[model samples]
Target: MRNARRVILCLGLALAASEPLATLATPAEAFAAQPQVYVVRPGDTLWGIAAHFLKNPWDWPLLWRRNPAIHNPNLIYPGDRIVLRYDAAGVPQLQVIQLRPKMTVSPIPSYHTGVMLPFLGSPGLIAKRSDYERLPYIAAADDSDTIFSNGNRLYVKQLGNLAPGTLLRVVRAGPQLVRPSDRKPLGHALIDLGTAKVLHDGALAEIEITNAREEITLGDRLVPETPVPEPHFFPSSPAHPIQGHIVGSLSNFPEMMVGQVVVVDQGSDAGLVPGNVLQIDGPESVTRDAVTGEHLTLPGRDVGSLMLFRVLPEVSFAVITVAKRGIRVGDALRSPPPEAPKVLGIAP
Candidate 1:
């Protein structure tokens, strides 16, 4: 009987809209007194949709908790209808209805699907000095070529026992990130140079370059190629309250824009994980009170938001998802507040 009821509920068959919108105290405030439905549109993101419906967008998991069949919520595509209704106990839940069968069948999910792809191919941060020292470095190249590219042969040192055909990525150490407040060193950003395959394995290994995104040259370090992240991931707030800063960005630009990757100072040790979203705030400044003639510190303004795609011990890689203003290196990052703001024109 329970299984039958679950099947019916998954099909979005339940009580009338006249019934009280909620029975549970907490989830009641998440939705309206009447049922609501939204049509997934092109360029729509789970985070954006959740923000449109719930008071605290990070509480999105609660909306889908009853829909166990949704193996990956990120697979939602344009033209799909998301129906919000109450269960028997008057608990609010969200269900996906395939409005256009063809659209959901192996269709590219949305623009937000692979936003993290460009930043995931190389190790984002090399925080420890010993780890940087242990990596194999490009030592010599044939034909006196100082800058190497595709189809070039190079020699590497400190390469451990590895057989031919092993693939590796060539990277150069970029900026050394330091905390904006205390100037404490966090890590060095790894700039991806190119990729190579082991041609000969010995005390000094020979590698043939296959691809080059940047100029691969001597002293470029070799680290095992990192796997690309899966396109599907749900967004949520950090499990622990995070109060960190934007130490630096993956690129040389002083100001970060949307779709650019930035490095944060806090990571897994502080309960941060991939898919956790954080808001960026501009630096607080000391200002003189106009009436009191006293110095007062003003709070930073919320400027943008980013989602962590890769996390390390003391730092993590986050892609700027929303940049309302020019986000600087010293900007602050924390969980989004519990205020509800709706995105207009998102309903079907």
Candidate 2:
């Protein structure tokens, strides 16, 4: 069932119809200093606004919980003002002041759906990684077909004695790349395609695809859904140093920008945790030294920032929250020091 949209009638300060609107305070310490009022600007998003106020874009889910007064966060329109207030306990709340024509932006599913579906490639997002295992690989299609889609019949091996109606998520082993340091293999990139359900039980199983975000080819793997990692994690700068590379991108666009998801070779094993913000550095710019007739290669500067969310053993996925320019594969990743300036080129 579709959940009912949330609604809240705000209770706070009122102004004289003739009084000029107040100036909004936006210092980083606005919450500690005084009540901060932010007028929503064009191209504003809940995700982007959260990063602007809280320095943590993915924490918009937390902000949603805190701001029971702003129902239907996505309904926020350009020119609407947001007020940031804190309680005695330092708990912050954001209140939306609707003073303009109501406008709604892109729809984002509830929290879990937003995080899980993308990394898993379930229905809405492109496949990012793939996991291969010896067992449970697709053996054949019901009609000797090589390709499959939602509602197509498939026979999968190694699902021994599974009960009817059991469901499985399809995956594929994407690629194997080695860590440059010790020549150790970073784990296989696992691509989660869609889901299937069992119809017959045995050493092997007959299953029907219930959904397919992408084409399911023979040799794709299957996994029982349940242990999908917890999606909510506190957003913060990395507690320690983190270094890695932009191993891949799922958005498929040759150029990526804010809100795009990128795969990083760094993970928990490398001291990376969810919400750890990292600076993205682009390729070095090689320039010619006019007088010396020599080549000068300048190091890449911080082009943007991304927050690590889903962590695998050797890799993690992060969404770019700020970008001065397009993000690319092979960009270097580095953890920023605490209180470091984060947004590059984008204003707060």
Candidate 3:
């Protein structure tokens, strides 16, 4: 009986020692698992490459945590090698291990030149008697035989005590201002007053209103003009367009029932072009904490998308195709991400 007891005690000790060794070996084996590497191909955007391993593209910012060389999150070139590692549960994680030389090439710089305009009401009037000195104006000829009825005549009510031969601009308000031209008053013409007249203020001025094209009217506003700078064009759209600020709106047309003619600050100079699609974003609301009396601003949510149909020197026009809610003026317009695979699990 004593010998049997001794053998049982020895077996139990051996089992306890072997159990710890087995547990340690399992984790060591997992650590030795090789990571998968993928080479980037031409025309492959970072978002595109990330999607192959990740279920969500928006989680791309998380990649920076693993790769320190990727300074600009938006910049990832072809021929770059990315590593994919799987956790013990077989969950994959992506990390940019190396960037090929060609992928690190810098892009050429583009010129940014354009004008900024305030939001104007649709069919808004340019009332007479407003100061238009040293301001830009558009000229239109009147059809009637009345003095200054022809388009050739100068009928400025805003130039106060200004001398003759002062250069002015002539612009006509129409659909062209809000569409393809994007508020850039079409057909800029120079104004030359033929005669001088006295007004109620005893100020000597040239108020001749001639209808050269038979379209000039008595109420047209006249202002000084400035030349548009060179290299004026729209900005090219990013692979993923994002929302930006809305600066103005054109609501005068009957067809514009939805107050549609809203103008945004983004344009060709900013890498935007005609036919580019953009996503409209708005501020989200968060529930207030009644006890703490604190209000939280929720993350911005996608509200709608706009398709750029017309582009101008500094502005562009897009029509809203889809809107979960009404798109308000001043909302941001941005490019949407390309269709690609997403990181399996990520926080948006």
Q: Which predicted model would earn the best TM-score?
A: 1
Residue-pair clashes per prediction, in order, are 0, 6, 56
lDDT of 2 by residue, 1-348 (tens): 122232333222211111001223343333344335767665444444545454434334444554566544545555566675544554334556664334444332212244345474332122334324554878887577788998898778888887789878887655554555566666555566788899997866789999887789998887776445434343456767788888777655877887667778878888877667788888789999999979999998978788776777687887776778899878888876444222211112
TM-score of 3: 0.34
In terms of lDDT, model 1 sits at 0.69
Each prediction's TM-score versus the true structure: 0.72, 0.65, 0.34
Ranking 1 against 3 by TM-score, winner = 1
Q: Order the candidate numbers by TM-score, best to worst.
A: 1, 2, 3
lDDT of 3: 0.40
Model 1 worst lDDT window (10 residues)? 1-10
Candidate 2 regions with alpha-carbon error over 4 angstroms:
1-49, 52-82, 85-112, 118-133, 227-230, 251-257, 337-348
In the range 1-348, model 3's lDDT, one tens digit per residue, is: 011110000000000000110121222233343124557565443333533443332334444545455444443334455555444555454554444333344321111111121111111223222223234222323345433433344334445765555434333432222222244432221222222222221132444432132244444444443433222122223544444665444443322222144555666677776545566777667877779979877767877655454555556655554466777665666677554423322211
> lDDT by residue for model 1 over 1-348, one digit each (tens)?
011111212322222212111122233433344337667677766666655554444555544556677555565556666666556765444556654333323323222554555457777678776788789999987677798889999899999888899889888777788876577898798876678999998888999999886788888899887676445555677876788998877666778788777889888988998778898999889989999999999999988788887788888888786787888888999998754322212122
In model 3, where is the ten-residue run with the lowest total lDDT?
Answer: 7-16
